[model samples]
Target chain A: MAAFIIANGAAAMGDDVTMFFTFWGLNALRKPENIKVKKSFLQGMFGKMMPRGADKLGISKMNFGGMGAAMMKTVMKQQNVTTLPELIQTAKEQDIKMIACTMSMDVMGIREEELIDGLEFAGVATYLGEADEANVNLFI
Target chain B: MAAFIIANGAAAMGDDVTMFFTFWGLNALRKPENIKVKKSFLQGMFGKMMPRGADKLGISKMNFGGMGAAMMKTVMKQQNVTTLPELIQTAKEQDIKMIACTMSMDVMGIREEELIDGLEFAGVATYLGEADEANVNLFI
Candidate 1:
């Protein structure tokens, strides 16, 4: 199976990270200025989940005042861990691969024209080829 | 890179659910009866300062505190998720492959004999095969 951590936490941990920009995942890869926001509890209770772009669902590191994202950054910083922005730059510099799903882009009305530069267009087969070979895979 | 969610969380969320176990992940794979008591406060504090496994340094889910473990189980039930024990059994039934790092086990004083049955012993090469092949990999 393909392990997907749709979230961007890995970048902050300073690991080589790649995100298959499918569905919500595209939010982060989209124009950086375009911040994705998640739906509210009322949505889930009414089956009206927001399912917004993924960057919206990031885990708050410290979760202070629901500032988990900021808290995470602080804890990691106190420990000398890297930040998400830094991770993105590092992965690109190190040649860590990033794949954006063509099908997803179409389904969500996204266009390659909308994505940030330096992304590759791929499909299920590409994801599977990478996932099947991994000894450890995760869907976060 | 590996994704490590404490198998002990089985009590908080049932184990039958699919959880990608890596790093201290193999800790839960140890036998339930042999599980050690929860790591100490000092250990937790140190872990807070160290990398993920600092708390799990000497413990696995199986031999960890029975009372504490049971409490985790109760919380998961209240939360409506699966239990850890059930997760392990489910992993077997689902054929979710789990690999225990030989190096960490060695450093932590664990032996193949101490782990829960059915674990695959592997090293960097094994992980490399998976990492190179997988589209998404993580270290949590």
Candidate 2:
């Protein structure tokens, strides 16, 4: 959530923002609806265990069986802070580059069609190249 | 562990490295010996619950009640990979700059006297200033 907020904030300020999702972070990019993609046994189990999308994500701290996430969302709504989905939408609207690490996707058996639209799938080398040119490259 | 390894690697290559420790990352910078400091009840509890130093830290993944961390350390030893403590020592030896986030320390109730020596304390503004001048700034 911090990553998205920062990315959106940077984009809002006319800064070119790029978000690279890898490993568990890729779960945030999964479509809310289940996508029928063939996978190995372990990957299938992994997929079933992991949350599908941003809304399904749990807060890192004090997530008492997801109650904390619900409370956080409620508080955020009350505070008029942009919700995670809204932040994601804003990111798309602002043309923030969202890249999913291809190596992680392959390792986790996540197919391209399983993720949302407007994402570029690439490897770490691409991220490194981008980082080289970027003034601030953050790994959240 | 990744942070320390990367810092050590970068410093070894003669690139000036600065590691800004925040939140749980501060635990790695703590002195192993118990330090008696006056604190609120909550602060004392927080300090007691958290790991004191790098050696007491657990692996993020597959750490089944610290067994996984022990297994990983053994494997790292077998593979000749630098241990976390060794990586931290190498970072110090190579003159890598390490800063502990003061805001995080206050929030987590960690004291300067409880932390290892050779660390600078600063806030986010200092991080931003350093990052602005950095060619590649990574959050991790």
Candidate 3:
């Protein structure tokens, strides 16, 4: 969410933004529905254990099971702050480059079909290349 | 540890590196000895609860109390990998700029005397300025 907030803010200011998702961050780009795919037992377990999408992700701190996330959503609605899902939509509309790390995807058993549309699949080398070109690069 | 590894690697390659520590990351730069300092009730509680130094931090995953970190250290030793403290020392020798966030220091009630020697204190704007001047900027 912090990464998206930064990306959205930068994009709003007319700066080109790219978000590289790796490891657990791949959860943010996952489709909500479970997509059937063949995988090793360990990978399958990992897939099942991880959250399905942005809406399902738990906060980094003070997340008492799912209740904390629910309370946060309620407060966000009250304060008129954009929800995570809405922020993701705005990011898409802004044409922010969202890249999913292929190595992480393979390790986590996440397939292309299991993720949302409009994401480039690549590895760390591609990320390094982008980082070298960009004025600012952040790993969140 | 990942951040330190990257910093050490970059510094080893003769790249200018600056490490900006904020929030819990400040713990790594702390002195192992308890430093007497005045603080508000909440701040005192926060200071006491957090780990003291690099040696005190638990691993991000499967840290069954402190056992996981101990196990990791054992493995690193067996593999002839440099320890976290050694990595930090190398970073200092390489002259990697280490900056602790002053705002976070205030929030966590961490006095300047509580931290190790050789550190610059600054806030987010300083970090942004440094980031803007660099070819690669990462928030880890």
Instruction: Write candidate 2's Cα lDDT for A1-140 as tens digits.
Output: 76886677567656788889999999999999999999999989889999999899997754668765675566456446677788899999999999999999988989999999999989999999998888777878
Q: Write the per-residue lDDT of candidate 1 for residues A1-140, one digit (tens) a residue.
A: 01222223344334455556577666556654433334354422322232233344454122335454544444445545445555555556655578989997666656676566788999989888876754444554
Instruction: Put down candidate 1 lDDT per residue, B1-140, tens digits, no spaces.
Output: 11223433342454332233443455556654443444444333322432232123332245354565556656768997765556566556555567777644443335566567776887544565555455445455
Top candidate when judged by DockQ against the true structure: 3
Residue B17, model 3: lDDT of 90
lDDT of 3 at A4: 91
Best lDDT among the predictions, by candidate number: 3
* Rank ordering of all candidates by DockQ, starting from the highest: 3, 2, 1
Error in Å for residue A87 of model 1: 1.3
**lDDT tens readout by residue for model 3, A21-110:** 876789988999989998766567667777899999888888887789899999999999998889999999999999998756765668
Alpha-carbon runs more than 4 Å astray in model 3: B1-133
Candidate 3 global TM-score:
0.60
lDDT, residue A120, candidate 3: 94
Residue range B64-113, candidate 3, lDDT tens digits = 57655675566456445677788899899999999999999999999999
Where does candidate 1 stray beyond 4 Å? Answer: A1-19, A34-57, A60-65, A130-140, B1-140
Q: In model 3, state the lDDT of residue A98.
A: 94
